[model samples]
Every structure is written in C-alpha cells, then in structure tokens.
Target: MTAREVTKADKAEPGSPEWLKLVTASKIPSILGISRFKSQFALWHEMAGNVPSEPISESRQDDFDYGHAVELAAAEYWRYKNDGWVISRGEVQYTDDALEFGNAATIDGRASRGAWRRIVEIKTARDLEEWGDDGSGEVPADYAAQVIWQQLITGWHEPANIVLWPQYGKPKIYSIEYDAQIAASILTLVREWNASLASGIPPELDDSITTYETVRRLHPEIDGREVQLDAALAHDYLTAVTDDKEITKRLRGLKTRVLDAMGNAQTAVVVDLKIATRSPARGDAIALRSNTKADPATIEGISA
Candidate 1:
C-alpha cells in the first residue's frame, strides 16, 4: 500500500455520522465473531443503518474514559522501555484512497524507528488472564483482529505491537506479525459485509448474548397477542430448558462434593494447577445482582 492510495479523515470521532459509515478497526472483531462485547448481527444492523447505535452504559463509559486517560501513559511506557523508538499520539483516521467499502481506522498511536514504522495499539485490562505473555502474539483474538485491521488500513505490514496496561502491573507489549493470508481473508470478509449491507439483508443471528439483546431491543413491545411457532424450534427450546435444569442440578451436586473435599479451605487445587478459589464477597457484592427476568410463559405461550 502506498501513501497515495490512502486517504486520511481528520477528526472523525467514534460513533459520529462519518465514523458509522465506515467499518473501523474496532468493528473487525465483531465481524469476525470474536468480539466479547459485540455480535456480528448487531454490527450488521448498525452498519446497514437499520437501527441506532447501541448506547454506552455508565460502567461502559467509565471503561472508555479510563482507556482514553491512560493511552498516553501506555505510549510513554512503551517508549521508555524500548530505546530509540519514537511514538506519536495523534487523532488520525485513515481509509483507502478510493474509499472502497468504507474501511477506516483511528489508530491509538504510531511508532517509528528510523525508516521502519509500526502501529501501536494501547489497551487497558482488568486482568491479564485473557492475555498471553509479553511479545507472545497470543493476545485475545478480538484484540489481535483489531491490530491486524489497523495494519491493513494503514497499509503497514510491519508487525504491530499491543501495549497493555493491566490493573496491577506495569504495561506489557504483545507483538503481532503480519500475515498476508490473514489480511486477505479479513479484506474479503469486509467486502462481503459491505455487500450484505448494500443488499439490505442483515447477517444471520448467532447464539451470543449480545445478539439476543439486540433482538430484544429491536422488538421491545410486549403486546397482548399470540403467535404460532415452528415445531422444530419449539421442540428444541423445550429440550434445551430440560437439559439446562438437569445440568444445573448436577453442577450443584458436584460443587457440594468439591466443597466437602476442600472443607474450610479457601483454595482448590489439583497437582500443580489451581482449580478454584473461594473468597468472601465484599465491595459491591450486595449490589451485584442478576438482571435476567423470569420467563413469563407456559408451554403454549410466551411473553417478554
């Protein structure tokens, strides 16, 4: 990719009208079905302009704010640890010069060493369990996809590094090597997604909670009505519910057995691996309650 073939969109705030029109790096994980927070169906609907963008809850907004606040700190740490590396923290967005399929990226930071340039993505995590050892290239699939998408948009195939700030430790870096095959596959997927948008057909639904919530939001009315159901779907639902009850009962029995073996111990272990740890519920424990509503239904009927 050449500079002449790449166009920059200045100051395109996320969720703005201009940003919504383009498939940014952050959306790649959703499209690839690896995003922990978003489902492909939700992304498809939003990109198709069929529904309003999902609102950010207060807790989610706090997460974003924390990430934005420490972005510079993460970048600075990266520079401090890696000698001779210069980092640029700028709000720059990029797309193809031809604007093909409207793919875009707003990189968190850019790094350069002499003539070699690399994309630097900053992330904050509550824990590093989901992340791999530093420089292992074993980051979460969603985050890895985000970096690859950034590289694709920036036309920089040089390996990009993810600078992560964990809750309790100094930052760590994960390096992702560029794979042309993966980039091509992602590009094809992006093109197909755009084609689906143009065709006015949303992506098929998955069994993700995000997808289920999106469906619920799309149809929020609880009207006094009854509708026919497909036989197969009804039978499957019944079977799933029955299995869920049996599984829950078995799980409880197993937990009781494990606790009996542990007997006043706080930690459960097997050989060298830690299986589970029991800790007293504190801070916000009283407030942390399930939001799931009871299913108001009989075998013959259903309601929200």
Candidate 2:
C-alpha cells in the first residue's frame, strides 16, 4: 500500500535515471517535513521502500480535497506569467551531478519573468498567517528545505512559492532565493538520514509528541510483558524521571510567579504579548490559545 507511483522508467532498470526520479521526484512535499522528528521515519521508509499504508484520516481527506485547487492556482499563475515571458510546464525529472545523493526531481512547473527564472511550488494552507512576516517571502522551514532540494535537482537557485488560502481569492507569492550553504547542510542531514537507514538504525527522537504517538500506534503496549533495556538506557530513563519531577516543580513555581504578578487582574500585559485570566467555575485560569482548529483534548467538553 505504498503511495509510490509507477512510471515508464520502472520497466527499464532499477538504478536508471527514471527510477531515481520515480523515487525522489514524485514525493509529496507536505509529508517531507525535515524539521519534524517523525520525518526520519519517512526517510527510512523511502530507503527501505517499506511505506506502511497510512489510514485515510480526517486530516488527510481534507488535504486531498484542497490539493487540486492548489494545482489549479499554480496553473493560473503560470498562465499569467506566460503572458509576459517564456516558461515551461510539464512532468520533467532533473538530476544534479554535484549533490552527494544526486536524487532526481519532478517539478510542477518552471517560470521566468524578465531575468528571474525559478521553479514554482504550489500549496494550499488552511492558515496563511503562520507563514510569517506577511511580505518578507517567508515560507515554512520544511517547505524551504523541500524547495531547496528541488533547486538542487533543477540546477536552479531560485524558487517561487505560490501558496493559496482556501478562504481567500488571491494567492500569496513568495520569491525565495536559497543559500547554498543551508542547502548543503540540509543535504548533509539527509545523507546521515540515509546512512542511518542503511545501518538499520533509527534516528534519535526529538521533541515531538507525534513521533511518540506514531510509535504507540504501530506497536501498542502489551500487558504483563517486560522488555529489558540496556543498563545505560535504563539508568537514563530513571534519570529522566527524576529530572521530570524537578522540572514539574520548577514549572509550578514559574506559573505561580506569573499568576502572582497578575493577582486579581483580568488582563496582564507582558510587553508585546497579552496574558488574560479567564474564570471557569470558582477558579481563574490563564487564557490559552490552541494552534489547531479543534478544541484542546485536555479541556472539558472536548474529546480526542
């Protein structure tokens, strides 16, 4: 149940350029979040060609419904650009000789207006404001890295990102110029990723609860079973528990300090940030904001 696409190159050979492109180019950029801790699993999956079928979750369905609209937005952008200069759009695979991986890339479209020549990546985001600086041409860090790989493949240093909002009629265009050093750093990280896969070693988990969730999903806890950890690992786990207790105490102290500072005040101003106290029953709690569209699972009346 791999999402890997079939191509005419598959009939030719395994290590052929087309085969390389098939593996690299057709990758959906949204899933390739290099910044995410779980992304290492994607790299591992690619190297091993062992992609487990991801269940069609609600979020995934929403993404699919919006994906085509983004493509159409890209197509329209190309149409407007073509009115001014020469640009090409098609399914093309590019391989870079300089990169260590030298993986192929299949770009959505290529465009040039005046002296500016760049590859275009189309996207649809539910929230557009998070991209940052409004007009400073800031894209998500993961997307920046993804486009950098595309640039490496296309032998193009510049990329124009067209991100459309489902609620808005106009698209926000980001003209990005990636630094070669940054791209090199990302490439090094990717090489290490592949090497880890080759060695059958999983990357160290970072601060992502999603990675933990993924592990739990794949292998649920077994009751009445004891798996032994190495001596050092077991010691580390014990140390972590001790540290967690200390951290919890310190966090409580910090919270108390903040609450005391706001004492009986409905609104507390912390420089540019606003901290508001909300009354729920007999207690007052800090007004919190959630990043997701849904209510917090920890909050009352909200379920997972």
Return the top candidate by TM-score: 1
Residues 59-160, candidate 2: write the lDDT tens digits. 778776677556766667656755775455443456555555436665566667777767777766543445642333467666666777777666666655
- Consecutive 10-residue window with the lowest summed lDDT within model 2: 288-297
What value does the lDDT take at residue 294 in candidate 1? 22
- Per-candidate clash tally: 0, 0
Q: In model 2, which regions exceed 4 Å deviation? A: 1-37, 41-46, 49-53, 78-83, 86-93, 97-102, 112-117, 133-137, 164-166, 217-224, 228-304
> In terms of TM-score, how similar is model 2 to the real structure?
0.59
> How high is each candidate's TM-score?
0.81, 0.59
lDDT of 1 by residue, 113-141 (tens): 99888888888875344664233336899
Each prediction's RMSD over C-alphas, in Å, is 8.5, 9.9
Which stretch of 10 consecutive residues in model 1 shows the poorest summed lDDT? 286-295
